[model samples]
Target: MAIPAQAPPAEEVVADPVPPPDRRRSILARIWGVYAIRRIVYALSVVWLVTTGTFFMIRAMPGDPVEVLAGKLSMSGLTMDVARVRAEQALAWDPNANIFVQYFEYLGNLLRGDFGMVIGLHNTSVLDHIMKYLPWTLFSVGLGVVVAILLGMGVGMIMAYYRNGLFDHIMSAVASTLSAIPNYLGAMALILIGSTWLGLFDFWDMRGRISIGVEPGFTGEFIGDALYHAILPLITYAFTITGGWMLVMKASTTEVLGEDYVTVARARGLKGRRIGMSYVGRNSILPLIPQVALAIGTLVGGAVIVEKILFYPGIGELLIGSITTRDYPVIQGVVLILTCAVIFTNLLVDLLNSWIDPRIRKEGAST
Candidate 1:
């Protein structure tokens, strides 16, 4: 009876249940949790919308490419019907085709990397036209932005350090006034003050992107000549934009200076230069990163006016000419390129910001 009691004492063990895999949720999280992937999708969607809008809007303009080319041909002694036929053949476009059909065709061509031929210009590629002129705009506007950011940030930090002092007061007023002035007006003022009244440099000499004689190369002479022509547009862009950067930087810097960490750094007996550079300056610059990306788009738009006034042969200049001639292919191509540039820059900046700031990455991942 004791042996039987001992044998009955063995207890059974129970295993814990395993959870099922959430395959659907895991897939969604993998796709959506990635910040760069989301941003790229958004950018691509924007490009598609812009491309669609640009295609329709250009067609909606008063004259069609056929009509415009025909008009020019009619001026050269061809009958209207004959001119239209020639135009249609040359442009390889059909005005009578279904609008939706044309749109789909355009999308197909775009997918295949075909921007189409320039209307009225026999066999000229739209991509070639863009490649030819885009660099000038990038050089002038891009250089101007860099210079303005550097100069503005330096002066702004100084203003923040010397807050309410005479230097600060003077700069604040000047920055406010300059920021209020339109860039085009500032450009005209430069022409009037520097070229017309001051006679510091001849506008005629600096009218184009570069002097005709200078060959395109990495040589110093070529570089100097290019800079000489870009100087006015550069000055206009830098001068007009610098004020805004200064104001923004001054505000950001001032805010950073008041933070507890800055006060603690001062308490720790850190040198003024070290505190300014390492603590205040670095923290203050974060907000400006997004703004700088946006400013690239704004500057490109402004280049239309500035380049037009200055006679610089950039994409802006090309765009203006395309519009004047009702060159739908060229106009569409240019607008598409501009839109892509803006979207690409913003997307790049978003990725860069996420990389630089762990907080952004964390927030994005949770969402």
Candidate 2:
């Protein structure tokens, strides 16, 4: 304290405080930082445009919607004159309302998630109908796709690792053949071979989510019946889906095998299995991740066709009914759901990738 009595001079040449250097961020990093918000905005915009376009397109169609509704009635043997059908349509929504006004109202309802009552089903809530069938779709098609992906990816990796070997060649040929066949064609073959000609799974019910009289529940009878009914449709989606995934995975893995890190791993005296798992397999899978995520939506689209053939009680089946009846509300609701599912899934995949990539994460953290 005594030594400090000589105070430090304050009059020494003062220099201006230097600011930290501005670090440059890469384009990818910038994209990552704003990715979530950007994706959401883009998705919403796409939805809006599509919904608006669909609404207008429906309005612009040559036939009157009321007459279309009446046609459905006629099919049911409940004959209705054009006048009465027009009256009914008027009650459905404001038929007389300005198109723009109707659009705004429609938009408002959509924002509130107010999918109106089903016209064809006579006041059956659209939401209730969707909820009823969506589970079946998820259970059957969703599960089938996931199984395909896992099995396909595994088979593909093995094929890639042992490229040109007997097992690989055999699998490749089988995969190519399966992939070349159309999904519906495969379904037909399965139907004909398994059901019509072979009679292998004759005890397995060919159509519907469950037996006609079986009450749905956790009971063994209901579950067993439901599973039995689901098998045919499950086979159609899973095995057909597997071929495409195998081809993709084989290509991706093959590409990754030639990369520098893989060579280094080999040089470091790593076991073949270890190198494959840690280096090649891990990277080879990255390309497939996006496709797998997108498959959720595509699987639903595929189910629409597959379920029609299988007669599964899924939303695809419901969609077919609504389309035939020209139930505008139901049609709109389903389309909206599909669009949302796809776009949102895309957004999720994009954000997830950013989070998964360490480089992106580090850059984002810096920002």
Top candidate on TM-score is 1
Candidate 2 structure, TM-score to reference: 0.77
In model 1, where is the ten-residue run with the lowest total lDDT? 1-10
Query: Model 1, 1-367: lDDT tens per residue?
Result: 4654455666777764743468667887788888888889889999999999989988888887888889999999999999989888887567689999999999999999999888777778999978899999989999999999999999998999899999999999999988898888988999999988989999998999878878999999999999999998899899998998998999999999999999999999999999988999899998788778778777886788888898889998999999988887888888888888788888878888788787887897786
The ten-residue window of minimal lDDT in model 2 covers 19-28
Tell me how many clashing residue pairs each candidate has. Answer: 0, 0
Candidate 2, lDDT over the whole model: 0.78
Candidates in order, TM-scores: namely: 0.85, 0.77
Per-model CA lDDT versus the true structure: 0.88, 0.78
After superposition, the stretches of candidate 1 with alpha carbons farther than 4 Å from their true spots are: 1-26, 258-270, 278-291, 361-367
- Residue 146 of model 1 has an lDDT of 93
- In terms of lDDT, the best-performing candidate is 1
